[model samples]
Target: MSQTILITGGAGFIGSNFIPYFMTAHPDYKIVNLDKLTYAGNLDNLKEVENNPNYTFVKGDICDETLVNALFDKYDFTGVIHFAAESHVDNSITGPRPFINTNLLGTFNLLEAARTHWFDAPNTP
Candidate 1:
């Protein structure tokens, strides 16, 4: 059976690099990349796996709970690799609100969705 994995921020530096590497290493796993396409997130970084059969790209914000839930329902992903964040220290110092919104709140939403869909429900015997 093939495994479906959700990779958030796949357009960012670390995620963009990891996606191709992970896909290459795990050919049986399909990767669903969700990126907001922020200034730091660029599709050009993911050119290598753009046409890969096991890869998919979604452009959206992690803060959007509706979209996130919809994706979870659609993919039924077996795993999630969350890399979305506001990582620039300078920017964080200059304007901290976005950092809080994206880093903390964004992570919370993903975790909440994962916990609800993956763990909270009763087990099927």
Candidate 2:
């Protein structure tokens, strides 16, 4: 079976560039895109792979632990490329709570989900 690879922020800048490149070169892998669709994340960025058989797009919050956990259970992803971070410094300066939560807590949620899902799987890496 092809390995399932989870990509957070798959619709954002760097992620938008990397996903296509990675998928093109790694045909043996499948991708599950989890994006919160922030302002910078445009659907057009991922138009190329949107309908590909190997790709799946999920729009949701990384901060939602239950959703994150359920996704892992549903997909059993073999690997994760964590690209979701609220990185705009300008926005962070304006109150910064969203940035803080989306960056740190979101990352933590991903880590926890990945750990729970992959910890005992010898083939996960």
Candidate 3:
């Protein structure tokens, strides 16, 4: 059976670099990529794996608990590779709210969703 792995910020620079390499090597593994597509994120970065059979792309807000929960319930993710964040210091300084929402609160939301889906409700399926 294939394991469902979640990649947060998979559309961003570093993360986008990782996904294709990982996907190529691990054909048996499935990836669910969640990215907010902020200014730092680019779809071109993940274009190779975007339509792969073992990959899924979701554009969303991690700060929204309901959305996070819905994603968890829908995907049944096994683990998370968190990469998403408000990466630019200048952007954060100028627009701290989005940074805070995407970094701290967003991370928290992803954490909770992972906990509920991977640990707490593992038996649901």
Cα RMSD of all models vs. native, in order, equals 1.2, 2.3, 2.1
Tens digits of per-residue lDDT for model 3 on 1-125? 66888888888888999999998888889998888888888999877888899999988877879988988778777778999888778867677998788878989998888777766774755
TM-scores, all candidates, are 0.94, 0.92, 0.89
Error of 3 at 125 (Å): 14
lDDT of 1 at 81: 97
Q: Lowest summed lDDT over 10 consecutive residues: which window, candidate 3?
A: 116-125
lDDT at residue 59 of model 3 (Cα atoms): 89
How far out, in Å, is residue 17 in model 1?
A: 0.7
Candidate 1 local lDDT, 78-105, one digit each (tens): 8999999988979888899989999999
Computed on alpha carbons, the lDDT of every model, listed in order, comes to 0.91, 0.90, 0.85
Candidate number that wins on TM-score, 1 or 2? 1
